[model samples]
Target chain A: MSSLFNDDSLKSIAEAYEKYEKELVPEWLKKLPERMEEFNTLSWIPVKRIYTPLDIKDHDYMEKLGFPGEYPFTRGIHATMYRARLWTMRMFSGFGGPEETNQRLLFLIKHGETGLSLAFDYPTLIGIDPDDPMAEGEVGIVGVSVPTIIDMDIIFRNIDMSTVTTNMTINPPAPVLLSFYVAVAESKGVPRHKIGGTTQNDPLKEFIAQKSYVFPPEPAVKVAMDLIEWSIKNIPKWNPISISGYHIREAGSTAVQELAFTIADGIEYVRQLTARGLDVDEFAPRLSFFWDSHINFFEEIAKFRAARRMWAKIMRDWFGARKKRSLWMRFHTQTAGVSLMAQQPWINIVRTAIEALAAVLGGTQSLHTNSFDEPFRVPSEFAAKIALRTQQIIAYETGVVDTIDPCGGSYFVEWLTDEIEERAWKYIDRIERMGGMLEAVKKGFPQREIAEASYRFQQEVDAGKRVIVGVNMFVEEEEEDIRKVPLLEFNQEEIEERQKQRVKRIRSERDKARWSTALSNLKRAASRGENIMPYVLEAVKAKATIGEIMGALKEVYGVYVEPPIY
Target chain B: MSSLQSISEEIKAKRPLKVLVAKLGIDGHDRGAKVIARALKDAGFEVVYTGIRQTPEQVVMSAIQEDVDVIGISILSGAHIHHVKKLMEKLKEIGADDIPVVVGGTIPLVDIEPLKKMGVKEVFLPGSSLKTIIETVRRLAIEKREKEKLLT
Candidate 1:
């Protein structure tokens, strides 16, 4: 590579690397428009038309884009994006037995990961013991299996619970896991207010995508609110919910749809909690977001910027959240998994780096970059380390973080932010007209919308209108061979047998009479429309396993039968 | 029932064989499975989606229920070797081993040899062409049915 900055003559050419319009002047005008029509991102935001001041024409900068850490925090979340401190470089790490996952956490922390995110296996998410027949052959495979409080104890074993921020990505059993965390914290003598973390507790999107939910929608929302109310009072530092649009994006939503639907879900949660008389600021400050970062460079950057602007406006105007923290849009970004193809999986590294750049440019508080080998299976250690190093390179070497919102003034970015905001609001209004996100989800509007968007994007790809480097165009004739390794090794049978032993031990050792008393108290609380968290804590202290507590609640709430998503 | 026969006949006429895709076991990573389902559907076969998390008994019962000529199993959670072998054994137990089975997803290239040895007709992996899968399933189903007819 030539030193462009050193030579004045090369600067113009280097700058024109992106300015194709300058090359295609009067002679090219006729051919350029038609050529422009051929290549576009999946979101279909055309290159030239994607950005401009006209996109944000109607907006008042002072009103909508106030200084960061102030009302209407569009510029940056905390006034000083990285000047104060760099964004939390958190890693979403978890797997195998709880002890194993804990060891991995320590390894990641050693490697300069600042915060934590947990990915529990299916059994933990669905409130089943690891030994349940439904949990067969899946123990510690996809994510770590947290069966009981013992598992949680093992997960956080020897880690400083009070200082480290742990985000648990479990929706259906979020409350169960959160309760177990609290119980474990109490055992560790950490004050509840000092423990900080966020749970993926948005159940509305569970119905929309990432279908790992248990319980009916209504009961699920109620359970989510129970956590919200309890967390507002006790876990002051904890974000009770992280409403996710990442899954929606992964499930094939357009960028606009992901923004709209995620904000709509946030609206419904606030409405539900506000209806319950909890102050918005008390809990709203803890509302976090998760978005998917993909290869559509500027569009995603625009999407994130627009999201902050939109969320800031919504909180200020609608909810009356006066606190600066309550109005900020703090989010974690993961590179889009759908963008990873099993073919030429090595190429995923470049794709991830590009996506991660979009995230940093768009102002992500934390990020999880997918490993190149992920589309085949869970990333191997070499792959995960590379994935982690990619982020480290971006943070340490890249100058992008030095300037907050580097794309803030780019005509393309500003135009995109405006376009996304306008379309997303229109979508939110449509959802509102249809009675809200939950009802729309039940009626399959959001699901169908995503499917339609995905289908249309594929149609564009098939027609050669969209260029997906390896998939549709610039194709390689031959593929390199992929070496195989053992998928995550775990003694599934042994874990279950030990769990059975633990069950027997707990059943035999715990005060059966006191357990029954606490169990009845939980059952009564569930049925009497009382806050079940208090009773859950009581039962937790009684050594009631997750199954027992959830079983008692199930007796009242009844198991949910999901009406099939068409 | 009439639509089923019509669809199957249309499939058999257009291609060379008809295959029914069914999910067996309580595994729910159906994004890939569903995409394949759509691909197979477009390839002119009667794809019977058993939805998320169905048991082996349910899979065989659905094959019987739909009168699906062939069964395609997609297992991704490292349970393919056991699940496919167990399902085939149960098909024999339930007197339906005459139905041919093909497996797919996350099968290591080496494990592919072992799976084939255990009587899986073939293993279609990730990036396998939807067209090839359709053609292969058709050929395998016809061959298996002819062999069964001779045995009877």
Candidate 2:
């Protein structure tokens, strides 16, 4: 592995860099001083004024970066990235009810959306029926509520499940939701092999960051693994678990935290699956990831590159994965939702565009650009269209896709990529020593770290160290005013009542004996330490609600109570 | 820093007001709530956080049992109006309505007025600074303590 620069040339470059920083910078600073005392990335990584060949003299290009579509996929996971295929412009759409979100999905597809990303409401996410007391006023509010297969039927009534891949953002009840999708597809005569989509069956992130977890970590992961193992046999094209970092970042972890914690979570998943005697190559290729493309342009790009490269090494060296596809790190990226500010909401369009560009440059497989009105409410149709158009404009107009790994060889990008990869590996190693993410999460290690980081970031913004235009920096005189921005109106009572009645009617109309027997079988399977996917599928076919199947499992697994931290 | 110092002094002058910081609904976006709770604690208030998925009834019961001077409910699920209404009703039913309730989250401006009319003492939306939140909660806690003293 020869270095990119020879020793003689490198020494010359190094001496030149030293003279420039020591002598040239002092003279330049005497005449015109720099703006800030210290410049850093949003994650607080110190940044230098400029990067040069000397900065990356030790790097071996063929060894470190390699070519796109090769092992150690630092350049990218694919050779002809956007030139051959564009990233899926999937808008995370859902609100009011299943029918309403279905309309929005169709609208997006009509407007050139390449894939569908569904967002379930709170009750559905935590495995509660709309009629449950805990679901009061929350039904169909944030996202589509699918308590049973009936609602799932309405959501994809005419849409061909085989044509477009749907990404459901449900966590704890992921198995039940996947069963409903399978049942719906079978009812529509689409075979199990042809059914395609991704169920975000990741429960570790639910416990660690999302806080929507239902059962305790061990049993929750068991249920998630059940879905993944079953899907490997049945739905060959489906990605069972999108091990996600989007929620972690949205929960206020720094960029490196998002990378390290998410990869740690993925490593835990692989260990859990391999413990069950399944071959690593069987499921590793179908495994996918999700990340938050934050506003820190170069740092975010480097983070993406680092994530791909790190995951490739982990799979190859740690897991002994020999398949080329198993070494590929394919992931979906979403522009940071937490970056959107309520004040001067229109400027959020610019923020989204910039973040979307970073995702494109980072070689994401699929991307979701957050709507500008996210901070105000569920995005209005007008705002969501603009968000989709933001991706379209970048793809067609920017000429960024004309080449693969456009920012692959830059000195700063390469240096930052290595820096982030090294920092993230240290975290992963620490978590590995602490007996992986589950044990670390149980000890509240990651949670406390995230809380500290979030608090410090808030303090920085408050002290005017970080400039969030229209938020803490650019003073908007008419602050707290979102009147002019059109908002999506929701009739909470009507939607809640409609969802409650749907769940109620499904319970009464279905074959009661079949539903009860299926639920009992599911409970027995869960208790006997058997795979719960077939039993869950039986329950879904019998018209059992998500709450009932999950409730049966909960009786065996018990509910997990989050200990207060912060 | 000066305002924070004054707020701390005022709390110290009093018996150190206890506040309930809670995620009333099922929404798990508690970054703002936790940050605000830490800020209030730093500002010399005793904060009892009811972690995520606490129903309004549970929150009201905790507020009454803890005898908090203020209740801060964070909801990002757009169900703030629904939960706050039930919370206020529960508080009124339990005769704990005097405990000032402050709501915060990604609440739209249209809902703010209704939430305030529903007896929410203050509504903090997105972009609300920690400084503003700390000062507002302090003022509300003092007002509630004074009203309780008058009644006693």
The alpha-carbon lDDT assigned to residue A19 of candidate 2 equals 97
Q: Write the per-residue lDDT of candidate 1 for residues A1-566, one digit (tens) a residue.
A: 21212345345545654365455454567665555544455576556633334434455666655666766566778778876677676777766678778887888787777888897765666777766676666666567777667778888887899899989998867777888899899899998889898898999998787777677788889988998899889888988899999999987789999999999999999899999998888878889999999788888998998899889888889999888777888998999987876666678889999999999888889899887766555666667777788888998898888877777767667767777888899999999999998899888888788866765665555566666667667666665534443234556567556656665677679878888898899899889888788888778777777777778888888876544332
Least accurate stretch of 10 residues (summed lDDT) in model 1 chain A? A1-10
lDDT of 1 at A407: 78
Best by lDDT: 2
lDDT of model 1 at position A16: 59
Query: On residues B1-152, what C-alpha lDDT tens digit does candidate 2 reach at each position?
Result: 68656655665586888899999888999888888889889988899998898988899899989989999999999888889999999999999998999988898888888998999989987888899888888788877766665677
User: Pairs clashing in candidate 1?
Assistant: A52-A415
| Candidate 1 stretches greater than 4 Å from native | A1-26, A29-36, A49-60, A458-481, A484-504, A563-566, B1-27, B74-79, B103-111, B122-152
Every model's TM-score on chain B? 0.79, 0.90
Docking class of 1: acceptable
Reference contacts reproduced by model 1: 0.13
Best TM-score among the predictions, by candidate number: 2
lDDT (Cα, 0-100) at A404 in candidate 1: 74
Which one is best on DockQ? Answer: 2
